[model samples]
Target: MSSSYAGQQIAFLTQHGKEQVIAPILEPALGCVIKHVTGFDTDQLGTFTRDIRRPGSQLDAARRKARIGMELSGLSLGMASEGSFDLDPFAGMFPWNIELLVLIDDRLGIEVVGMAQGPGHSSHVQASDWPAVESFAAGVGFPDHHLVLRPQDQDDTRVHKGVSDWTGLKASFEQCLAQSGNRQVFVETDLRAFANPSRMQHIEQAAQDLLKRLQSCCPECASPGYWVSERQPGLPCSVCGRPTSGYLTEVWKCGRCLHTSVQTRTDCAFAEPKHCASCNP
Candidate 1:
């Protein structure tokens, strides 16, 4: 247990059995006991199933969950996590997953977020026959990871989620197939933490990030979660000696007192000439 939060109890809000992964990482790292807070429908904030669209940004949703947990458990410190899936922005070819974990301390009026992103397996297949469905399942690591079934058009409200076995998947496929006017069913990997090992690993990484932030303390006010708040770009090009769109400094700020410090990258001193407009042009 770290010195700051030793022997403390933090409330974690979740409905998808996320505690199974999160608790194991956070409890030992932070030296705090995590109490799962239930009875609230976290799906109201959003869902991966597309049943209810997410209302706000991932950070906003995570903060809302943390606050709800605090209110329910009557604890000053709370934690929550949210995940989003999309195409990788840089390459725009492979599926990407962004996992965010939020820690809120009402006692200090501070909130900190830890984030992790990587390639994800979020593919979906629309098929009408059993052979195609089976092929898709095999490709997605079925039985180990779960699947969700819905109408091919993707507008239908009815969805069968958390289908792990072949028997359940076949039944769900036939049911969704009958409901679809085009006799097609949409099958996708279940993005839930417990259902997807890859997603759960990302969540664990986010928890580790949170642990690091929690361990970091502000030099000015001695508050936890002192981290980089902004990046200062404009690293000079090696050839042209002109500024490029590369980061020059990282602005670390204290979450409580807003005290800031600028630190330069230790990896490289100058940006490549290829990144400089003047050099490249």
Candidate 2:
């Protein structure tokens, strides 16, 4: 296989329409062509709405999706993305979206995973009427942002989704309120890449990270993808010199070879005295 992806075509497995957001970042970085695979039912693999729950970790799911795209496109290289939303992976108060991008090269037998997290606002709301719905929608960037609505009635399974227009919004709002037995309507953000600009930015960042890693070469084995796989935690307290629960070094490894390298953490050199167990306890 060639070292870089220049002039190579990569298939992207996504039925939720992710090509526009992912392509702009990946094409220039990797110098590759990105084609969307339309035949695959990516929703069947997993859904953000709780049906057909994603079967594996973000990285694993991305790899599987990438493989499917490659097989369909008859290309040796594939690229895919997966995302999840939660109450912040780092320190925060509101929910956040975490997106992962995967690049698979069958010829080289290498898988590169890049991940990024973006601020998430509540995509959900409970509204009883059009007035309430309008107010709620405004908060979630209505008209410009899409939404999915489900009736809250225990017996109602009908879901009104992909709503973006005022007409559709009014109709779905009335339908949901009537069918919900006066119960609230469950409104959530339509997390599709095209619908959410924040998610698109997250995917773009992940693609850039993947490309940066691809540009690196292992010093020992000379692999094209050489970057940190993990980090070691144990920065010493500046005064006490006792190990503290902070990043000490990053462990960089080559994707193609088993070569590894460790370098001191760039963000910090010493743990605060208050963070040290010996100094604080």
Go through the candidates in order and give the C-alpha RMSD of each one to the true structure: 1.7, 2.5
Q: Please, what are the lDDT tens digits per residue for candidate 1 over residues 1-281?
A: 23677789999999877888888887887788999999899989888888889997999999999999999999999999999999999989888999999999888889988889898878888898999999999988897889988976666778888899999999999888888898888888999888888888888899889988989999898889999999988899999789899999999999899999999988898999999989996
Query: Each prediction's TM-score against the native?
Result: 0.94, 0.90
- Model 2, residue pairs in steric clash: none
**Model 1 pairs whose backbones collide:** none
Give each model's whole-structure lDDT: 0.89, 0.80
